[model samples]
Target: MKSTLKKLLPFAVVGVISGATTVGVQQYFGHTSNNEDGSYFTTSKNVSFAGMNTSAVGDDFVAAAKTTVPAVVTIKNYQTKTSSRASEQDMFDFFFGDPTGRNQRQRQQQAPDNMPSGLGSGVIISPDGYIISNNHVVAGASKLEVVLSNKKSYIATLVGTDPNTDISLLKIEEKGLPYLNFANSDNLEVGQWVLAVGNPLGLNSTVTAGIISAKGRGIGILGGQGKAANPIESFIQTDAAINPGNSGGALVNVNGDLIGINSAISSTNGYYQGYGFAVPANLARKIVEDIKKFGIVQRGFLGVSSLDLSDDRQVAAYNAEKKTNLKVGSGIYVTSVTDDSGAQNAGIRTGDIITKIDNIAITDFADLSMSVGSKRPGDKVVVTYLRNGKENTSTVTLKDQKGGTSTRSKADLSVTEKIGSDFDPLSERIKTDYGLNSGVVAKNVTEGSEIAKIGIVDGYIVLEINGKPVNSQKDIERILDKYQGNVQVKFVDDYGRIYTKGFKMP
Candidate 1:
C-alpha cells in the first residue's frame, strides 16, 4: 500500500506541473494579443486569461478623444428672422419648451431680440481653415461665426453647400489650422469602436464613445421640415450619445481618424436616445470637394428604385408579389429603372438583384445609394448582380442628373433649378395684358424657393432678371447660369404693379 501511494503521489506531482505550465502559456498569449494600435479589440471580460490578466486594455477611449476633440468647433448661424421674438428655440439647440435649465439658458442667449441665429458644430478638415459641417448648421445664415477649440472666433464665409447630402463647407481667412484627417468609412466594420467629438447641448468638445452599430442606415431624417427637397440619406448608425449641436462633428475611428460626420439622432423627443446617425466620411468628402470646386454637387445616379431584403417579412411579401422566387433572398431587389440612368445604360433590368458594387456587397438600399452617390458623374463602377441565381457583372459608367457623363461647369447650372421656380414663356394674351412683347411668366413658384421669398407669386411676369431680358427660358437660364451673389429680379405682379426684389444666390 505504501509503494502504491508513492507512485500515485509522483503522478499527481507531474499533473500539477503540467497544469502550471498550461496556465503560464495562456497568460502569456492573452497579454500578447492586446492590440496597441486600437484598430480593433475584444472585451477582456469575455476572454479567460486564467484570471491573471484582468485590466481593461481596449476600453480606454482617451487617445481617440484627445486626437479628435481639438479639430471640432462650434458654429453660430446668423440669419434673418421674420419675427422679432425670443420665443423660438435655437437651431440645433434643445427642443422648444425644454424644461432643462441649461436649455433655458441657451434660449436666453441665442434668442435675444436680434437676427435668428443658431449654434451647431463643425469639423476642420484642412490646415488652411477649411471646415466641413452639415448644411442645416449654416443654411440660410447670412453670416456664420466659427469658434475653434482654442476659443478663437472667425467670421467664416460660405464656400459651398449641398442640401442633398446635408453637407456644407466654410472657409475662414486663416491658415495652419489643426484638422481631422479623413479615414475610409467603407472599411469600417460593425462593432468597431468610434468616438464622437462635438458640441452637444452647447457644450463644446464633448466626446462620447460607442461601437458602429450599423452601416448604410437610411432614417429619412435629413431634408425633413422641407430643408432639402431631394435628400441623400446613407447614415452610419452608432450607439454614441449624439445630441443637438453634435451635427457636423467628427465621428473618429479608434485610430483617431475621421470616419463620419454626426448628422442626426433617432428619438421621439428630438434628442439622442441611444441611436445616432452620421454621414459617412467617404460621401461627405466627395460632396465637399464638389461644392468647393464646381460650386455644385456632381452626384452620380444609379437610377434604379429598389427595396432592401433585410427583413424576412418583406422578403416574403416580395416573393409573393413576384410569384417566382424560390428561397435565398439577400441584397436589393430592383423594382424599376429610370429612363436614361446609368443602370439603364448598363442594361440593368427590373428583375436583376444587385449583389455587389466594386467588390463591396450591397446589403440594402442605402448601400446601393451610397455606392453610386459616392462617385461623381462620369465615373465608372463595376456592378455585380444576380439574375435567376446566375451571377453577372457590368461596368456601368455613371451619369449626372441630366443624363450626361460630362462634368457640369458652374456656368451650366441653371438658376431656375437653384431658385426652385418653373418659368414659362409669356403667352400672347398675358403679354398683351402686361404690355410687354417679350417676358417670362412664373408658372409655378415653389413653396420654399428663394423666388417665393421675394413675394413673387404664380402668374407673375418676370420682366428682367439681373438686368437681363427674360424673353425665353434660355434667356433666364443664360442670365442666371452660375450667377452668384445678389440677383435683382424685376417683375410685374398679377395686379399689374412692378415689383423689384434683390435676392442673394444661395
Candidate 2:
C-alpha cells in the first residue's frame, strides 16, 4: 500500500506542475479559462510586485514642474539715450592735453546714440496680460519685452511702478496667457516648503526648492546707492538659492500657488549664498490691484513714529510714563505724532502704547506698518492702545500722504488760484519744437497752494485738460472755460509723460 501511494503522489505532482505551466502560458497569450457555460475568467499576467510604489513622489514633482514652468517668463528691458555725456577717459584726455589737441579730441569724441540694455524676470499675475516684477528691472527702460514659456516674445508696456516697494507692473499686448494665482501669504508657516521659479543667472525658467526660513525679517538688503529707498523692510526670507536674475520671479508653495515675489538675495559675491527673500504675495496683490485702478499705490499712514518696546530704555520710559499692569516690554510705544497726521486727526497723542491694530496684536513697528500697509487709504481700523495706564480703543480713518478724509471726493483747492504770477509759460521754441498746442509751464510755487501741497514743483508742464490734449497754457484756459466746475488736468514735464491731477475751477 505504501509503494502504491508514493507512485500516485509522483503522478499527482507531475499533473499539478503541468497544469501550472499551461495556465501561465495561457495567461501570457491572452487566453483565459472559461466554464462550460462559456463564462470567461478575468486575469492579468503583468502584476508588479512593487505596485504603485513610485507614483506619489516621482509623478508629483513632474506634475508640479509642468504646471508651473509654463507660467514663468523672462523679461528684457531697453533704455533709449536722451543725451550723451563724454566718457571719463575722453574727458581726462581733453582736459589734460594741449588746448589745440584737446579741442580736436573733443570734436572727435561724440557720445554713442544707442541705448543701454538690461534683462530680468517677471511673473504673469493674471490671465489678461498683467505681469508683476521688480521696479529695478524696468526702471528708465524705453522698451520692455517678455518671453513666455512657449518661446513666444511680446512687447510689453509699463503699467505703473512703486519705487517705495520696488514693485512694477507691466502689460503685454497679448491676452489669455498662462498665469499663477496668488496664495494667501498670511497663512504661510515658518517652515513651509516653497519653490523659487525664475530666469536665474539668465537660465530661463529655472526652479529651486527650499523652506521658508523666516518671516517678517527686516534685513537692510535693498538699501544702497541708486536703489529705491524703502522705509519698510519686513521681508519673507527663504533658503531657495536665489541669484541675480531671480528678481521679480514667483515664489510658489508646494501646491504651485504663488505666495511671494522673489525680490533679493543676501550675498557678497553677487550670487546665491543660501539666503533669499521675497515680497509677500498679499502685499504684491494689493499694490498691483491699486496700480491697475489708481495708477499708483494709495499708501495709508499712521502719522506717528514709534519706538519698539523691546529696547530696555524705551520699555522703561513707557512703563514710567503710564502706571499700569502692562509688562516692561509689551507693545510699541508712540514717540511722536506729527501734526495734521491721521493719528493726530484721530486724537492719538504721544506716549500712547499701541497694543493692537484691528484685531492683530502689535509687538513692534514692523507689525504696525504691515497692518497699515495692508489697508487702503480710506479703510478705517480700530486701534487698541494704552493711554495714561488705561486701555482705550479708537476707530481711526486712514489718510493718504495728502491730508484728506476717508473719501474719494475731489480735494478742495477753492482757496487757491489757477495761475499765480509765479507761473512761467513754456518758451515758443520748446513748444514748437515739441509739437505743443496748449499747456502750463510751472514757475515759482507758493507755500500753501494745492499744487505746492501735492509737491508739484517748478518746470513741471501741464499737458492735458479734462482728458483732452493741452500742449500750452492757452489750451488749459480754454478747457477750464469749457468746464467751469471740477476738472482733471494731466501734467507732463520736459520729458513726454503724463500725470492725472484734479483741481476745482476758480
Candidate 3:
C-alpha cells in the first residue's frame, strides 16, 4: 500500500504541473474568437483587446490622437488625361493633319502626361508599411504617392482594390513605421467616443472627435452608373467632421484602436454638414488581408434576393401583394434564390423570411450584407429563417460569385482566361489608318467575362497589355504568361478614346 501511494503522488504532481502551464499560456495569449469568417491581423499575432475597456472612466483623447495621427498619410493620385477634343475630326485635324485628302494616315494623338487628380488620406495598419485606403482614392490612378506626417514621401504600390467595399490595400518600401491596430467593431456601442484622424483640406495630421451616431447603415452611395457592381454598405455613422480629404482616413476609438475607415459624408455641399460614414474595421481588415493574400476579395454570396424589412413601405407593398400577414421590421423576405447557390442547396425557398445569420439579428439589409460580405467563399454559416411562421435553421456553405466552394488564387487564371476573349492581329488597314506600330483586336468576347464586364466590346484595339506592346495573340500570351496579379490593358475604344483599365488574374 505504501509503494502504490508513492507512485500515485508522482502522477498527481505531473498532472498539476501540466494544468498550470496551460493556464499560464492561456492568460498570456488571451481568448481569441474562432469566427467562421476567419480572423483579421497585420502580423502573426492574434487580435486582442486586453485593455480595451470602453467603459473606462476618462474622456481624454490626447493619448489616442497622439497615437493615431502619425499613422495617417495623405495620398495623391496622378492620372493620365485623355483629351476628348482629340476625338473629333475637326479638332483632330487642328491638332494633327486632315486624313481624307492626304493618303497618309493621321498621327495618333499623344496622351497628356499624368497630373495629380485627387487627394485623400490613408492609415498605416502595420509596422511593415501596409496601408488601408478608399478604393475611390486610388481608382483610375496612373501613379500613387503617399506622404507621411513627417513630410516624407514614398511612391506607393497598389496591392489591390475592392470597389465593392471601397477599400484598397497599398504598400510602401519602409520598415518599423508607426501604425494603428484594428479593434473589433462588433464591440462598439452607440454614443461611444471616437476620433477621426486625417488630412482635411490640405491640413496635415488633423484630429476630430465625435460619438458613434449609428450602425448598420446603407446609404446607396456606392454602386450605380458604371461604378462598383454589387456594392456593400454597412457603415458606422458618426458626426466626426469628415471632409473631402478625409475620405480614406482613420476612425479610431478613444483607446486609439482603429475601429473604422472614414469613407463618405452625408452632406449637400460636399463638406461636413453633420454626419459621416465609415467602413467598419472588421470588414476593412478582412478586405486588406484578402487583397494581400489573393489580390482580390474572396466575397461569399448568400444567393438570395430579399427585401429589407426595415423599409415599411416596401414591406407593406410586399405583404399586400403576396397576401401574407408579414409585419414590418421583422426580417428579410426572400423573393428569389439563385440557382445552384448555397441558400438553394440549403433548401431555402422563396417567401421564406431570413431572421438571423449566425447569432446576429437581421432587421435591415445592411446587417445581412455586412455579415456575409466579411466572409469568404467555402465558409459555412448557420442561417436561421422562418417558413410559414415556423423557425428553421440550416448550415449553409457559402460560394463565390463563380459558384465555386474552393478558395481562389490570382495565379489560378491566365491572362487570356481572365479576359475571356480571343485576340487577332490587327488588319493592315487598321494599323496604317490608326498610325499604329502594333495592335490586336478583341474577338469573340464572352459574356460575363472581365473584358465584357468592363464594357470592352468586340474589335476593341489593344495596344498594350500590362504596358507591353501586343501585336498578336502570341504577344499577349508572352507578356502575361505566368503573370499572377493585376493586369492593365490599354485599349482604343470605337470612339478612339484611349482607356487604361485594370483587371485581376482571377
Q: How many residue pairs clash in all the candidates, one count each? A: 0, 6, 0
Local accuracy of candidate 1 as per-residue lDDT tens digits, 133-178: 9876765455688999999999998887776777889999888888
Ranking by TM-score: 1, 3, 2
Which residue segments of model 3 deviate by more than 4 Å?
A: 1-59, 83-115, 316-327, 414-506
User: When superposed on Cα atoms, how far off is each prediction in RMSD?
Assistant: 18.6, 24.6, 20.2
Better of 1 and 2 by TM-score: 1
Q: Per-residue CA lDDT of candidate 3, range 32-101, in tens?
A: 3243343322254654335765334244588898899999998876644532211122212222234355
Stretches of model 1 off by over 4 angstroms after superposition: 1-60, 83-116, 223-226, 309-329, 418-475, 478-485, 489-500
Count clashing residue pairs in model 2: 6
- TM-score of each candidate? 0.71, 0.62, 0.70
- What range of 10 consecutive residues in model 2 has the weakest lDDT sum? 10-19
lDDT (Cα) of model 2: 0.63
The local distance difference test score of each candidate is 0.71, 0.63, 0.74
lDDT of 2 by residue, 1-506 (tens): 00001111111100000001111233422332234443323468865425546456435556656667888887875543431111111212222333343222122222223322445678898888999997666654546788898899898988877655667899998778888999999999998878888876456778877789998764543332113333445678899867656778888887788898887666433345678888889888988887787665677878787877756765667667866334557687787998887788888998899999998888766677778877777788889999988998888888876666543322322122333213456678767866776666765443223453233445667666577865445555555553567767567643455667664553
Candidate 3 clashing pairs, residues 3+ apart or interchain: none
